[model samples]
Structures are given as C-alpha cells and as structure tokens.
Target: MTKKNVDDYLQEGMYGTRLPKEAERKHFLGTLRERVILALTIGEVMSDRGLEKLETEMKKHPNSTLLMNGSVAYKFLKQERDLADKYKISHTTISNQEHQTEIGAVLTYDHAIDKEDIYLSNDEDQEKSDSVEKDDQKDQGIVERIKSWFS
Candidate 1:
C-alpha cells in the first residue's frame, strides 16, 4: 500500500503540482527542514536559557525547522519558502506566505521533470580536441625536421 506521505497532502495555491514519489518528498522535506533549522539556530543573540529552550524545542520537532511561535523562526521560514518558490522546489501554496504554526512552512515542492538543454555535443567536443591535438603534433614534427636540417 502507498504510504500516506507528502503526496497525500493537498497542496493549495502555489506549490508543486506533480505528485512526487515518497522518497523524493522525504528528501525535499529533509532539505527544507535543514534550511529552516539553520535559519532558526544561527546568528541570533539570546539568553542561555532561551537558546537551550530553542534547542530543546527543535529536538521536539525533528521534521520541522521552526521554533514554535517565534517571529525570527517565521522570518527564516519565509525566506526559505520564497527561495523554494523561486527555484521551483515546490508547488505554489497560499501557506507559503502564511506562518506555519506546526510544521513551519509546508513546502509542496514543484516536482516538474527537468529537461536538460545542452548546446554542445560531447562527441563533437571530443572530435574537435582530437583534430587540434593532431594538428599540434604535425606542427611539432615539422619544427623538429627544420631544426635537424639546421643542425
């Protein structure tokens, strides 16, 4: 049976529309969580008590990155959400703007299959390099012959 994971989630507004596999969803969630955690943890001057409490609270929500009801946490979440949206990491969701009280920014990543548009072919590159090397070797041989004649 398909596990009830992020795919089961109803992403409203601006979020990933493509239904990601469970593994992909988990990976995306993990990345987003890490970003959120970093945001919540770094570059803040707080009392030892507050810092300890924050750490404890973070442990409580391993899957999440926000400290509950923290404006700073929300700020970081918003930043991360914006970046996610910009990069098409997830589908657009109204909750992207709204502060997440529980999970802290439910990221429904945009799981669009990306198509690589490479201009240069590897074979063509290899052929060009080979031709250049052959020309260089011929030139070197010609130079050596001229040097021998002079000698």
Candidate 2:
C-alpha cells in the first residue's frame, strides 16, 4: 500500500480539522522584536500590569529581528483588544492609531538609505583632487626648469 502523508495521518480517514484562518496564522507568526517595540510604544497608554502581560506574551516568541508585518499587526490587534476590554474604551480608536504609526515605522525601518549620495559626494572630491594634481604638475615643470638654470 502507498505511504500516507501528514494530511492523511491528521485526517485519520476523515477531513482534517479546519486550518487556521489567514489572519490567525499571520498573527501567530509575528516576531518578538516587533511585539516588544509595540508594547513599549503602547505602554505610554497602558498600565504597568498591562505592559507586564504584554511583555510576558512577547517572551513566548524567539528573540530576533526578522519580524513579519502581518504578525506585528496581529499582536497589535490583540493588545488593543485587551486594552479596550480592560479600560472600557473603543478598541477601534487605539487599533487605528497604532496601525497608522506601526505602518509608518515599518516603512521607515525596512527601507535602507541609499549610499549613492555619499558615493556621488566622494566622486566630486576625487575630481577636484585630480584637477589640483594636474595643476601642480604643470607648475612643477616650469618651476623646476627655472631652478635648474639658476643652479
């Protein structure tokens, strides 16, 4: 008989349990770094207890810089939900503002500053140096000839 795969094993002769939703999966895979940063930023609004809980939740993830945006969004949403429930405020307000701020931070951090600006500046300096060297060479030839005659 053919070997069964993981899906077959999971199904056990019936359809496997429904897979996690896309958003759920994304949220589940969010990075610790993003979560910590989010917590710190939000701590400005949340209580020490809330911040502690958030930090505890973040500790469950591996410490690394490679956090995914979807996961970060998921963590933010979760925190916002918790804070809203705790403080009796509209979750939408915090979520919307945090979403905007997070989006801006992610865009800024992910983009690398181009080195072409420094490179172009250095090239200009090099051209100037080359021109000075040529001028010095021309001056040296005539000056050297005069010195030789005087000697």
Candidate 3:
C-alpha cells in the first residue's frame, strides 16, 4: 500500500479542517465581543492602579477562556492606547515592547510567589537580624533588673 502525500490528502478533502459554519463563526465573534467588553472594563478600572488591581478585577470575570482569547487581549492593548490619548502621549510610547515588558514583570512576580523558598537570596537574612535585634531590645530591661538585684 502506498502512503498518501500532502497533495493527495488535499485532493481528498482531508488535509485542512473545514472552517466553522457561518452561524458558528458569528456566535464565536459574539462571545469575543462580550469578552473584549469585559476585559476593557477591567482594564479601564486598573489603568491607574498596578497589577494587583488588574488581577483583582480580572478575577471578578471568572471566565478563564476569555482571559486567553485574542479579542479580550486586545482590550489591554486598547487600554494603553486610551491612556496615551488621555496623557496626550504618542501611541508609539505604549508599544508592544512596553506590553511585553509588563508581561515579563508580572510573570516574574508570579514565579517568585510560586517558589517554595520565599526569600530570593540570603539578602533577606536582614529581616531575621532585625527581628533578633527587636527581641534583644525587649530583653534589655530584664537584663538590667537582674544585674541590679545581684549587685
């Protein structure tokens, strides 16, 4: 038996999958529109706030698929555009590069949170030292009283 080639498969109507029907496409677009609207509303509210605010607003939506959809993603792009307009800044100032940087920063923060060790490095040992100092200060009065009683 001979194996069918790409051209043979195309000729047999088995290469590429069929496109969605018109009604299905329309329904998909309608869902996209709704997701975009929701994302836009969240983005607008979060424009002046940080990622924590954005995440909080996005959580309210509760539709994970909407978060991954391109139409909904465009809402964030549009948000930066709107912010640029409000500030009278050029659209180029809020380019895809900026968006990518923001995404990177957010992902880094998420990764840090997911890590078992909370401290990034031994540099955080300063917090431990500070706590020890506070305890020493609290015990200083007791130490003085003991010394006075013995004297």
Output the number of the TM-score-best candidate: 1
TM-score for predicted model 3 compared with the true structure: 0.22
Candidate 2 local lDDT, 85-151, one digit each (tens): 4544322222232232322111011223332221122444687999999999999999999999999
Off by more than 4 A, model 2: 1-117
Candidate 1 lDDT over 47-122, as tens digits, reads 1112333344334434432322233345544554444444434322222233222232232212232323211233
Q: Give TM per candidate.
A: 0.28, 0.24, 0.22
- How should the candidates be ordered by TM-score, best one leading? 1, 2, 3
Which ten-residue region of model 2 has the weakest summed lDDT? 102-111
Cα lDDT tens digits for candidate 3, 20-123: 35343233332222223222233332342333333443344333222221333454455544433444433221123212221111101111123232111232
In candidate 1, stretches whose alpha carbon ends up further than 4 angstroms from where it belongs are 1-7, 12-120
Clashes per candidate (backbone, < 3 Å): 16, 0, 0
lDDT of 3: 0.36
The predicted structure with the larger TM-score, 1 or 2, is: 1
Give the TM-score (vs. native) of candidate 1. Answer: 0.28
